[model samples]
Target chain A: MSRIEVGQRILQEDLEWAKANSLLFHKHRVGCVNMISSPGAGKTTILTETINALSHDMRIGVIEGDVETDLDASRIRRTGVPAVQINTKGGCHLSAAQVNGALGQLPLERLDLIFIENVGNLVCPSIFDLGEHAKAVVLSTPEGDDKSAKYPAIFARSAAMLINKADLLACGALDFDVEKAIGQARRLNANLEVFVISAKTGQGLDQWCQWLRRLVSQVKILGQA
Target chain B: MHEAAIAEALLKTILDVAGGQRGRPLAARISCGQFAAVNPEALCFAFDALAKGTRCEGMRLQVEIRPVEARCSACGRIWTIDDGYSRCPNCSSQQFSLLPEPPLLLESVDFEDKTDE
Candidate 1:
């Protein structure tokens, strides 16, 4: 028997879910950020610090994704903001459908910004579209500047990349080159916004927070219709 | 593996196509682009395991990792990217775009008709 040929997309439903999430967020006037990076890249710390800095001015919520445990959600809650924990059960990344469900658990009308802390993965997380207004990557100094080129998939897709843990570079012990890193990233994505920040020392967080404020305001204006 | 979900999606898509048709699925083809985070081997394994005891069982799966194609925004030259991206081979312009396409796709599915004896 001749083989029947049918052309289709396998992840069509998932893509639809992501697009729906994006539309829902836009309608609600909420800015969503998908934060992705390697494990131990201080994603939790960055979240806590960013929440502390901005929670006073705007309403912020979090969707924490991890392989296991609700520790990050607990930390985010400590800042007095709502956080929903998602356990992937060893999954390497967060799916848009999962975040769609988590979005329902938060106070959407009261929230201006929502951050989805993707499972600490530089690779798999980049492929999934959570329908965020912006996709940001947090690269710590120790993970090396070479990562951008090595993992072009993520750097290429990210709208912004934060070089985190700048505090470690103060001692001149780590041989990470900040300029080289940005330069490498630019080769793949010239418009990519680069921020050299330390969540521990609060070095470049002002600019980071400013970017968020801008994104939130833009969403506000767009959602006014 | 991270491909399990993707594989599951593949299975579901196939079932949707095979619903009304009277046939046992024979094979399926997938194209995994360079930008996709999927590992072809892992995807195949996951699909095989998930398809067991299903109508799509014993379906041959072919996953090909397509080379990345980038276009020079200035010179309008498009070429396949063999390795890490840096500059255009023709113009050396860093201003280029990785031709936007889906990172992964189930390109096609092959089904066989069952004949009444």
Candidate 2:
């Protein structure tokens, strides 16, 4: 009996699909951001606020992923941007294949930016690559700053982190240490960019929008190059 | 939770590589980093359940977990860390980059060749 050596990735098929999706985005010159967070971490709220803040200057589309409802998609549609809802039917996280199917329904040519609101999960979603140019994680102050330490995998892979619900901290309703959160995240990912914002109060959103604009412009430039 | 999906992927990968090779898979060696957050027990359970009808039915999944390694850009010191708030043990710099590597990988597969008989 002879033993054969096969050295490859177990998720090679998924990785290939993710790479193809990325190429599709590049071909359309659209910047895609995969947004992940724990349930009730204000992902939908922050997404809506960000859409309202930048929809005029930049054309935006959204792919909402949920376990059972299209409620988030409806909210995004109210803001006048195209939205596609993907109900996973109890699936823990959205997979690359699912995202590829959703991309077909989106008007890629008309959108400069597409935000994929991943399943409200901090763990499983972090493990999958959805072909997004950047991964932005929302961590609400109410969820506690220790989450960065608790879920290091997500923090390590995120390109940018939004410390949402800062207003709650301002009112002393929540005791989240923003400094410690940023420190922990940075320790895991030294290049991670941290932004403290409150979606309800429109606090610190301008900078977030600016970063989005820059990312879109950079993607456009890369497409040209 | 996602271990099922990972196991399915593992099965698909093994089958694709072992494609009509005339042998059943005996074992697979996989490597995951501390930051991968994979539960080995859960993955094995899922793999065993999913492999019921596949060629990997009784295959063994050997997982190797590697510690998270970082190299300080400032001091150029390399260190392995188990905690999330990893600082270079030598220079105590927070400004270090994680060693570039895939968090999870199927390093190799061992399959017995049945054609020899």
Candidate 3:
């Protein structure tokens, strides 16, 4: 018999279920950002800094995914921002279904940004699309420039790239060629936007903040009645 | 690592497509491009794990890994290699080469309906 090819239709019922909760979050004019990176690349630290800087201007919420710990959610709660944690119970990456479930618990209507901090891994998160407008991939300087070469998919799929730990450049053992990393990333995704900053020293954060502001503004404009 | 989640996605797709089919689907053909970074055996095992209690039970999954080879406009040579190689096989020219990313796609399912006779 002749073969028929079909497009990838993610299980509809499951997807619909995922959005059932998240759609309400968007109804409040919230924009979600899925931050993915390898473990110890400093995702939590970066997010903490972001919240600290923008909390006053923007109402932020967080959805933290980890193998087994409420530690991250606790950290976010310390800042007094509404945050929910989803312990995958050992899953490597967070699924859209899991995020959808977590969103129901969040106060989405009052939020300007919803950040989903994914389980720490470079591979699996690249494959699953969590229905976010943009995927931000974080790469630390000490993680090495070769990281992009080894894990191309993560960098390729990300709409924005954040090079964190810039302050460690002098003392750190790793020699990162930021330009080369950016070039390699562009080779894969020509439209990829690059941002180099240290979540610790706060170097180069203004540009990133500007980028976020622009994205939020665009979403607002698009959602206008 | 996320094989289980991926397996779930694959099974769901199979069940949805097989719903309108004639007899129970006996086999499914999947085309996985080299760039997809998916292991066929792992995928098969995952399929088995997730399909046990689903409509995809007892169905055979046949995965075909498509080669990532392209003709180099610079050297005019076509070569087959793994997903990692991006430079031209003959001239090592990145400019005039075409690289194919591995894409995962469900090709078709096989079944027969006796009631049509």
TM-score of chain A of each: 0.97, 0.97, 0.91
The candidates, ranked best first by TM-score, are 1, 2, 3
- What is each predicted model's overall lDDT from 0 to 1? 0.89, 0.89, 0.77
Candidate 3: misplaced stretches above 4 Å?
A: A1-26, B16-24, B32-36, B53-58, B65-104, B112-117
**Candidate 2 overall lDDT versus native:** 0.89
Clashing pairs in 1: none
**Judged by lDDT relative to the true structure, which candidate is superior, 1 or 3?**
1
Per-residue lDDT of model 3, residues A14-118, tens digit only:
456546644654567777788999998889988888998887779889999999989999998898898999999979888888888788798776788889899
Alpha-carbon TM-score of each model against the true structure: 0.96, 0.95, 0.82
| lDDT per residue as tens, model 2, A104-213 | 99999988999999999899999899999999999999899899888888888989999998988868877788998888888888899889999999999999999999
DockQ of each: 0.64, 0.68, 0.31
Candidate 2 DockQ score? Answer: 0.68
- Across A122-156, the per-residue lDDT of candidate 1 in tens digits comes to 88898889989999999999988899888888888
Whole-structure CA lDDT of model 3: 0.77
lDDT tens readout by residue for model 1, B1-117: 669989999999888877867878788888877878678788889998999999998888898888878888889998777776657889898787777855577777777867887
Model 1 quality (TM-score): 0.96
Per-residue error at A188 for model 3, in Å?
Answer: 1.1
